[model samples]
Target: MVASTGHEPCELGPIDYLVIELPQGTTTLTEQMTDQIIRSVSDRTLRILELLIVERDGAGDLTVTEFEELTDRGLRGLDASLVEILAGEDVHNLASAIAPGRCAVVIVWEYLTATSFTAAVRASGATLVAQGRIPAQAIAATLRGDDEDA
Candidate 1:
């Protein structure tokens, strides 16, 4: 089930009876549906922004020779300009209007941090598992029920 942020109330009764409390006024069924659609699209755009940042930072274009040396990888055919363009399209002007503080820009920033960590690990030739158990364990620890041990 999708988790709502509780900014809107949900009803379990007849669809026609559903009402949404908005800043303007109580919203009818059509307005509520429209709000839901808009929120969904915004969330999707943020996810895309996160992905683009990951791709841009992971492709080894933002850094220079030090970055290449640190990663122990050569960027022989990598196109820095193309990475910049891809990253640019990930964010839209609407992001600032809809989610100024926690918007697509924040997502991109977080992704860049994560990408840097991954690159450092890769450069060290450390036998750290990129995915699978470690991340799963961390998430499980974070999301464990109140009754479960940490």
Candidate 2:
């Protein structure tokens, strides 16, 4: 199910991408969806940060800016919510308060999706089926809390 964007071809791998078209004058959930996705991704990112702090030696004392620089790989399209959360006072202060000898370290995994991709499509008020790279088996495993290789 390939839905043409009428632009360059988007290679979505094997996952089925649904391009839902919103009807004329249809109510959009773009803001709501963006909020939800941002929150979820931010929370996950925070968790990863916490884990990194725990794993690295003397990593509890880095500044927020330092952490941002270190983890700046895949945050290209993060929405404002995520940026705010990352730059919040608490996070900044925490990074700054690390022990004198310790440096803050954060390990980030690859983010597979963009913050605005789904929201913008939803806002466009259109529905169409498109092909993606997300494997159905992987999605099922995720839903079941099983390993993807299982």
Candidate 3:
């Protein structure tokens, strides 16, 4: 069951979420990154289901804002307006992982490339039971046999 929502079993594609943190006072959302995202959306490679931002102040106070809110706060360079699809619980959950004095961009996206496979699975009455992500650092450490550090 989806958190904070009623028991409505909706058919969803291979959706995934990511929380990307930027260092304090860092502005890494360059024009190139924006262009790449626009291209992907235009090509139907993926769809931005949700977009949220979390900012942690020096005193460790957290502030969660939606896409439009962020744009209103002098972040008006993006060419797209993402939907506010995340629930309150989702914002809190993603915010909990971010560090103090840092900023994080939480995005929930659907992988269009997996549409056919997901459709097939749904047709067979096989629902996705579970899913998890292993961070890139962990994968690299395991591949290099750096178990101690990992």
Best by lDDT: 3
Residue pairs with backbone atoms closer than 3 Å in model 3 (clashes): none
CA deviation > 4 Å runs, candidate 1: 1-110, 130-145, 148-150
Whole-model lDDT per candidate = 0.27, 0.38, 0.70
Higher-ranked by TM-score: 2 or 3: 3
Over 4 Å off, model 3: 1-11, 72-81
Worst ten in a row by lDDT for model 2: 47-56
> lDDT by residue for model 1 over 95-142, one digit each (tens)?
223221121111211122244455555567764443432344556776
Model 2, 74-110: lDDT tens per residue?
A: 4434432221223345444444434444434332322
Candidate 2, residue 38: Cα displacement in angstroms equals 11
lDDT of 3 by residue, 1-150 (tens): 222236755445567888889757863444565576667777888778776678878787878766666543233433263556688887887787888888887888877777777767877888778877778899899999999857
- For each candidate in turn, the TM-score is 0.20, 0.21, 0.74
The most accurate candidate by TM-score is 3
The true-versus-predicted C-alpha distance at residue 117 of model 3, in Å, is 0.4
Q: What is the C-alpha local distance difference test score of candidate 2? A: 0.38
